[model samples]
Target: MGVFEVKGGRELKGEITPQGAKNEALQVLNAVLLTPEKVTISNIPNIRDVNKLIDLLKSLGVKIEQLNDDTYTFQADEIDIEYLTTPEFKEKGGGLRGSIMIVGPLLARFGKGYIPKPGGDKIGRRRLDTHFEGLQKLGANFEYDSNTNFYKTEAAKLKGTYMLLDEASVTGTANIVMAASMAKGKTTIYNAACEPYLQQLCNMLVNMGAKISGIGSNLLTIEGVKELHGTEHRCLPDMIEIGSFIGMAAMTNSEITIKDVHYDQLGMIPQVFSRLGITIVRRDDDLIIPKQNHYEIDQFIDGSILTVSDAPWPGFTPDLLSIVLVVATQAKGSVLVHQKMFESRLFFVDKLIDMGAQIILCDPHRATVIGLDKQVPLRGISMTSPDIRAGVALLIAALSAEGTSHIHNIEQIDRGYQYIDKRLQALGARIKRID
Candidate 1:
């Protein structure tokens, strides 16, 4: 396992650029399988999970050419569809949660798609029922093999229809939309996930000749087309990373600037951090977070304790709740972080507690953080990263603490963050990668 040796108590400086969206890359990269034509994508993050997916595509015989470090052109003109039945495919497919997305496009074009049970962060139970059930409603046959732990879907000709989703799942919505794009008639999806990443996917599909309406709303309408062509796309700056940077600057009492972030798309993120008493000055597309020795949490309008909670898009993202929780440890007031989507995400608070943060784990879903207000500084210790989000959160904590910290299982962090230690080191942070 990889480890990050981070020395604490130094304030970071200089400007940092957020990488391309990891979530959007996963969705759009799979969308390349929807067409046989060439799809060129720019600003793709060179992270472990995305690279693993690219390798998986290569294994499926998708002709891929690397244009640069963060760009690729893929053409699925000749796919080895039968390779999905191989043990090698199972092992590769099971390693990535984004692997499930290939099923929708494959089933639409090739009549069949197979995948092993997908794996990702062990934060909580992420059900595949949303993906399968949504595809099943679009006239695909869904089957699960208990003995083999594999999922299979097939459709000769999918006929579009209206369906209401049980939840606004981002990946689920993207999967069903890809399948529906080539179906027989109009498909109406209510309660779809309308995140900016999903919107980017829809826009890319539309550019490729897919008839999609309601690009940025909960309700989407797709008119089936016989085929989709290819188009060039550039992913937006990662909003989660942008949020993490904001929290990190405040935690370490540093002045930093985040560049080229699509400000309009980052709904509620800046406001939420500002509620934690962080100053975010928007200059053009850049966000300048000035240094502050003490930032306080804001109370509610009724003078109640502030509560930071995660909701679906158009709300604060759950991915940054861990960052917010860690930042609040140094604020002047308390805030309750309610992680509604994942049960096990809050479990990482115990590690923060060990570093002397005043946090109360109310349950599996919520944490109450009482700010030390810099009256007491956290002393660093060795810890293990549990998942991608939590790993970065812990890294932010360690950067602001008083002593050195060793973080094990940093592969979890590398899976999402691209050259994070190097990036931090550029900002005067003393971080080293121990391979």
Candidate 2:
């Protein structure tokens, strides 16, 4: 296992370029299986999950060539469908939750798809019934094999139909959209997840000749065609990474600038952070954050304590709730951080509380953080990462602590952030990655 030993009490300063969106990159790469033509992708993040997906694609006979460090050329001209059923492929697919999406595209184009139980951040119960439900609505038949815990889908020809998802699950919506893009007729998806990542997937489909209306809204109308031709598309900048950087700068009292942010796509993230008294100045494609005193938590009109919560897109994302919780530890007043989407996400607060943070874990879903306001610096301590987002949160806490801190199980952090130690080192943060 890898570990990050962070020497704390350093103000991170410098310009850091955000990497491509991990969520968007996974869906876009899987979409390559929908066509035989060459697809060139730029700004790809070099993360573990993406490398695993790339290896999975290579095993399936997708020819991937590296044009440069952050660009790749992919051609799924002669995919070996049998490769997907092997133990190696199944094990790789089981490591990434997003890999389940390949089942839809493979089923739509090749008549059948097989997938093992998917794996990801163990934050809560992630149901694949939504994916199967949406695909079933589009004429796909699903079968589960108890012997291997594998799910298979088969459909001779998928016919478009209207689907109202049980919940606006992000990956579920992406799966159905990719499958429906090559179906027989028009497909209307209601109550869909319209996060920026999903919107990028929709836009990529449009670029590939699939007709998708309502790019950034819940109601998406996709007019399925016989086939989709491959086209070159650059993945969007990662909003989650951008938000993480913002939180890092705020908590450490650092003046940093994030370059090449897709400002328009980051709908309400800036405003939401502003409620916590962190001001972000947008200059063209860059977002600049200045050092300031402790953040002030905004209150409701009735003078009640403010509650920052997550909902589907056009609302705050649950992925950033951990960053918000960590940032709130340095703020002035109390704020309720509710993560309704995931049950175990707030359980990591025990580690933060041990560092002298004034946090009250209301339950599995909510936490109240009373900020330290620069009066007391968090002392460094040894900790274990429970999940991806919480691991990053603990890393942030460790970086801002007063002494050296060791964070074990850093593979959780590597799953999302690409070369995080080096990236932070460039910004004057003393983080060393050791095995």
Candidate 3:
């Protein structure tokens, strides 16, 4: 674990670029396992989770070549199937939640896949029922071992069929799609997640010779193919990172431009922030959040309290609600942040509350944040990050606080973000990394 000693109240000024989408990159990287040819992927985020998946693939005897700083070519000509059921895979695979995704590609190409219990942020009960359920509908026999907590799937030849997912789980949808692409007959996944990350995965698969329709919609149709070929894919800019930077700019009262955010793709994020009275100017594909002395929270048309909650795609994402809650600290008036997805995500407000922000945790899923309105800056304190998004939210709060704040357990932060301290330093913020 490491600590970030953040000296807050600095006016940051610069243009920053968001890294490649981490979620999309995870799915894309695992898709390379479906083909034996060389698959080149660009704009891959150099974060811990992505690196861990790459390392796991390397252990399976896949040929990997780093093309550049943010690109790599992976060829899965040979794989060690025996390695999947070993204790070492249990240890290494448990290191990341994305490890479960590798099972999809493995099953698609090898007719069998095994994944030990995967690990990730402990924000809530993130279930893998959707993943196994969908793959099961595709003619895969899935069994869970209670003792070792591993999921093993085997199928001689997968025959696709119709499936309506219980929830539009993003990773679950991606997993099923990768598996279904090589199955026999047609696969129809209704209520599937249609986020840009999933769309990017589908697009890349289409380029690799998979037949898929409904690129940006919830219902996806896939006609199984015998085999897939090599393809090049570039991950889009990280929308979550872009939103985090925007929140940081607002919290620190800085003028910042998040370059090439792919604004056309951000469904409701810009407008959602605008509701907090944060003026976001769109310049082509960039988003500029100017430093402001004061901004007022917008009430509902009924003059009711403003409530910013999370929903499925085309709605505000649950990932950005934490950033929105933190950014609301210095805005005028109050707003209710209903996380909806995870129960423990809003609990991070306790750290912000300790920093002197007026926030009330109404329940496991709701928090009411009263804006400080720049009347008083938050005072720094020592805290630990509980999860990935919360870690970034706390960092933003610390960077805008009145004094030096210590944030420990930043390994959670490192898993998702790439070189966060260096990126903040480039924006003229005062932050140091210490062990």
Clashing residue pair totals per candidate (backbone < 3 A): 0, 0, 0
Against the hidden reference, what TM-scores do the models get?
0.99, 0.98, 0.99
Candidate 3 segments exceeding 4 Å error:
none
User: Which lDDT tens digits does candidate 1 get at residues 1-435?
Assistant: 889999999999999999999999999999999999999999999998999999999999999999998999999999999999999999999998899899999988999989999989999979888888888999999899999999999989998999999999999999999999999999999999999999999999999999999989999999999999989999999999999999999999999999999999999999999999999999999999999999999999999999999899998899999999999999999999999999999999999999999999999999999999989999899999999999999999999999999999999999999999999999999999998
Better of 1 and 3 by TM-score: 1
Task: Give stretches of model 1 more than 4 Å off.
Answer: none
Q: Write one digit per residue (lDDT tens) for candidate 3, span 51-164.
A: 999999998879999988999999999999899877888899999999999988999999999998899988888889999999999989999999979899999988989999
Local distance difference test, candidate 2: 0.90
Deviation in angstroms for 215 in model 3?
1.1
Pairs with backbone N, CA or C atoms under 3 Å apart (clashes), candidate 2: none
Q: What's the lDDT for all of these models?
A: 0.95, 0.90, 0.93
Indicate the residue-level lDDT of 284 in model 1: 100
Error of 3 at 238 (Å): 0.3
RMSD (Cα, Å) of model 3: 0.8
Off by over 4 Å in 2: none
> What are the per-residue Cα lDDT tens digits for candidate 2 across 1-435?
989999988998889999999999998989999999998899899998999999889989999999998899999999999887788888988888878989888988998888999989898888899999999899999999888889989999999999899999889999999999988999999999999889888888888889999989999998888888889989989899999999999988899999999899887789888888898999999999998766787888998988999989888888899999998998888899999988999999999998879999999999999998879989999999998889999999998889999999999988899989999999999999889
- Candidate No. with top TM-score: 1
